[model samples]
Target: MDSQMNAPWSNCSIGYSCVKLFPPPMHTVPHSGEAQHRTSPGVEGRGRMKRGVQHRSNGRSARKTRPGSESGFEVAHDFGPAAESARHFDPARRGYTWGMIRFTLLSFLLAALLLAALTGCSRMRFVVDLVPADDGLTETVVHEDDDARWRSPKVALIDVTGLIADVRRPGLLTRGVNPVAEYVESLRRAEDDSRVKAIIVRINSPGGTVTASDVVYRETVRFRERSGKPVVVLMGDVAASGGYYLACAADRIVAHPTTVTGSIGVIMQTFNFSEGMRRIGIHADAIVSGEKKAAGSPFEPMEPEHRALLQNMVNEFYDNFITTVTTNRTGLSDEQINTITDGRVVTGRQAHELGLIDEVGDLYTAFDTAKELAGLPAARLVKYHRALQHVGSAYAESPTGSSSTQLNLMQLNLDGAAMHDQPNFFYLWDPTIFSAVR
Candidate 1:
């Protein structure tokens, strides 16, 4: 008999008839071709142990019989219950994983549908309204309107507020609305509408870039000459410099009694970080094609020649401004023009005295003036407003239906660096306000 065998890992046993064979402990196995027989009382057999024997606590095993035995004999092995339980749990775990995946996918689809419905319901735009007074004068409501306002004569009101910039840098993501584009569109709309008898140019700005101011001024003049209609400027809290430049083109310029008007001049400013950089141990070398190309670079100090060159440009702009004012206010002498256009801000009353503006009046007075100039008894006031959409716009809000109409000072200061990051000239009132806080 071959009696070589491995000991049982667990407690188990196998037998034939009444001949039981219990599992042996480790380290006491018979060698190959050797016999280790334990004879029972009721059976007789010659047996040899095999390589692998195992046991279980329950005394059950996977059974197999040995062939050609003189008396019937067997072998078996058993693993513990821990291994059997793991096999039973696998299907339930697979089902739970798939169920969670389906739930997550369905949630995302529902959320998208809800967002789409809300977006469709929030569409808002503006219409010109005419509220008739008892005295037959039509009160101008430049905001939301019903169908009745369209029946009256209309005067398109275009707002020229906030900083005016000719921002044409390629690939630049502009934060707010472009005043030039918006103003031009309003003019075009007024030009096309036969019902619009006149235009009321509402101005509330401290002015901006030279080119941008000229653009608005030229456009207003051209629109007036081309359409054979009248334009009346209504000055708000502060309409100075380029704001006044736009007003110069109008048939009549009306200002509120407290309005600050006439800061008629040009300005150019640049910062030199050379000394600061030097203290911090930084040096930069420039390779340039021309000596004047980097004239106003903040990285280096401005040269005397560059200063002279820039001053000449400012003078040219100043002359152009003087010419515009003098030509418009035909009664103003050269000395009067020289006295008033000294970059000093004045009250609307002072401006009227200086011949810079026509009258000191309120917005309704401006409407009346526009009506008189256009020869219309009553006209409806129409203001252009941006349509509300899902994406946010950073432009200045219109006067009507808006709670706040002024730019935040802190935000403007923060954007100061970006506004003055490049070299440029301006037709502005105060350039120091846009300097970095430090």
Candidate 2:
């Protein structure tokens, strides 16, 4: 009997049932004539121990008897409550809930509606591509009356604002447009348009380099001769010195009642730091071929000859300014011109009384004058700009499109390195450095 109970078990027959079985502990030995049954702790036996059958904890019927069960019996194992809960769980139901399904359906519906709404809409070209090419400037209509006919005769509006220079003005992070080039280009554009009968040059500047101002003045005169179009000047807050020089090219000049004009002179500014350097125990020496080679240098004192030489140059440029004014302003007498040309600035009303400007009225007055000169009963006002430039109306700010900031301290612009890098002659109106003696 001991040998039979210790033997390996065989596969169950066709009529029998089978389950995994474990041998009892060595300490438990069963008597030969009786059958033995074992259970886990905390579980109680529900029925008598039979020789060839085993009971399950779930209360199922007893398994069929095995072929060798008379010698040994099978064991039925139960996992606890965890296995019981897993038996009835559904994985598919947990992953796709009702709320998640509704959200997904709503998203699909919204996308379909949006697509339907956009189906028949006309496609707009990207504005980036509408930018003008390098060869030409963009023309925009800033003002048009309700009754104005389309493509009627136009009066081009050109702006000359801020410091006028031929080279690009340096800014914080980038370089600005060359004022001279921009002015010339706008004139060319206006000249080519046959519909543009005339141009209104709006000037708001305190003057700039002498050569730059002269170049613009010459170009404005050339534009009028070639195009046969009348040019009118509209002065803004300040049009003095170089600004006045350019205004001389216009056929007629108009200024606002409060505009400041007429600073007809030239200036060359310099500083001497030799005294401060001497106090700091610093001395500078220079070897020159001539005594005047280093004239007007900041490191040295101004010699008597140096002073005389600079004064002579200032006088020559001043003479040129006086000539330009007298030739354009034929209404002014020689004595009156001499009086105001002493580097004095005057208001628009005062300038009109002195025969410096033609009229003392607002912008519309200038427009009406332009229309009468161009021989047009009704015309549209247009402005020229580059791509990405905003010129919504004739009164758009900074028409020169210069991004350079003029940081002034004691009436000196800090960003004006172009003026200070070397000794330059200017037709400028700077109160700190210049004063008029009546």
Candidate 3:
């Protein structure tokens, strides 16, 4: 045979067909929520193969091949079904999801920390902690160790220095430390102690509100009567008006040689900004229920009738003041009381001359007087004292060594003026002290 003719197609060719006896059955690829089928047509007696992939919502896939038909011959022209377009996986999507979770957690943690800081700082802003004078009787000792048996009868000194004002508990945003309540507490302690034979109230104030002075006076009188322990008043640099009123409750009063005393009067005052308001081109309007309801309004001028109404009230308090002074100083004649009852500041010598005080002396002399009144030959002299709320530097004089605390008149007046935005009755030495400091 010739080479080309004798070959007779060594392998299967398009013209010379071959066939298998059996072909596998076709199968459909399974996909979630959907079904897809792939097929390929073939010539007679030739089997074709189809390929398909199942996809999931999670971006995962499985490969599958559909079996050829039940034909004897296999088709040569068939190719696997095109693979489902390869999906590009991005790493940023996973990173973004984790990042969102972290950011939310961090935001919550930061907010909680900020809230805690604010809460703590806000509470600290106006927290007024009061540490009592003598830490509430802890500082005083009646006697030394071996000499305890020989301790003398004690005389407790209660200082009524600075402003004799009422005490108020500290508020969330306002911190006010009060010495009056502490002083009163000290007196009560002295009253209950049998070893304490007497009490001396030392005054160094120019006076304060009428009600506060009366409260101190009343308490002193009650102490004297209840315990039968004499109370002697010792006047220092400035004890007048309300200070004097408290002194009148004492068994005897002793004043230093140049002590300023006796501004026996009541005063009520306020400001009228009508002229200033006009200059500033501002006006005020108030809706009131009655004509006298806005009695002390600073926006308008005070009428004569209003002045009379307030003066009458002041007169009543003055009369009470005069009666108290006269009643306390038993030997003072009405003429003598009237002579010095005017709001006149007097020296200790002049006060002695007018019989306003029992004696002209120093603090030691007053202590001796207290001992004599209480029938004690010698005694331990103790004064109740508080640590200074604010202290001067180490180089400055120690407040503990000082006889009394000096009040900031400007601050006191400003506080009073703003208390109710109205004028108040005072047993103060100088009404102008309540005037604008600047």
Candidate 4:
């Protein structure tokens, strides 16, 4: 006879169980790993035995049997609790158990209604991907009105997509806010939020102003220092010049193999468009309170007086930027840094060779680097993309967009108007920049 099973997993040996019914694919151990020693309990008479070792059943494992076994006739129980319980049919015929059925039906409906309401009430965490300039400027408010701030705490992914400069092509479309001011505000928020464990600064630009880049770097530094949260810079296609400068503040830096980076120098470029203007027949004039007031103006031929002044200013910023980089990246030889810092962009492989980058890989590697910096066992790699669901994009917290305003250009270029007697500048002007115009 086939004995009735009582225990949850007590059918013969594990060998027999596997033969009779194998564990699901998810539960099955792979054959390639180390071999494990195991025994079955069925062969050991129902005593505590190792798995896969055979054992037999005994009195210690007695299982109860169903009654009426002699004739093999099934036994029946008097389920009709009493005459009162027999009223089930009569109540059904009458369409209810008087007021009790109505009360039960009402209770069930109420419960179902509550369950449905609860479904809608469930709060979903939609990360608002807001920066500085985005849909936030609109008069309409989505998700929550009356509160100017995001309904939830925002964690930004700073994706510097192009050459960061005072003059930039306006983005045709984006999923989130782009304004540099928004980035500042987000940094403020991230610093305040204990929930934000780490920030992934995805830098993909050729770099921009010393001041703008420094703002991001400084705020990133402050966020880490104040909150003890790590900022990991993930270099994208081209994180050079100001891009790498900002990344220097990160606890760790990762870059794609093809990522162009390590411009680790500073630069100041004025068209000296005096020649270009002369060619175009457009003469411009400027008056200043001070002699060096319009030091780097492009319209006029660069005066010897202002040329040295502007060069000195650029030199000071270059030194500051270099200092910040050296402080952030330790163990690199000064000579190696100088080699890469000659205002030359290098690939990630070359960057690793020059010790400018930590790793050579892509987004997953960046996530891993951030995880390592944050000291997390394993963080959920989630993309914080903003959703512009509403027509006017009421979901945006700041529509400032990705780049800084021309008005704020002074803050970056002047660096508080601090200058040096002698200065060396970082250069990133393409050797063939004139070819673009041609």
| Per-candidate clashes, comma-separated | 1, 0, 2, 29
Q: Between 2 and 4, whose TM-score is larger?
A: 2
TM-score of 3: 0.61
State the lDDT at 303 in candidate 2: 97
What is the clash count of model 2?
A: 0
Q: What root-mean-square deviation over C-alphas does model 3 reach?
A: 18.6
**Alpha-carbon error at 80 in model 3, in Å?**
72
**Full-model lDDT for every candidate:** 0.67, 0.74, 0.65, 0.54
Q: What are the runs in model 3 whose C-alpha is more than 4 Å off? A: 1-135, 139-150, 168-176, 386-422, 431-438
Q: lDDT score of model 1?
A: 0.67
Report the lDDT tens digits of candidate 1 across residue range 312-393: 9999999999898888889888788788989999999998998888999987788778878888766666665644322222
Q: For each candidate, what TM-score against the reference?
A: 0.62, 0.67, 0.61, 0.52
TM-score of 4: 0.52
Predicted structure with the largest lDDT when compared to the true one: 2
Output the worst ten-in-a-row residue range by lDDT, candidate 2: 10-19
**Ranking of candidates on TM-score, top first:** 2, 1, 3, 4
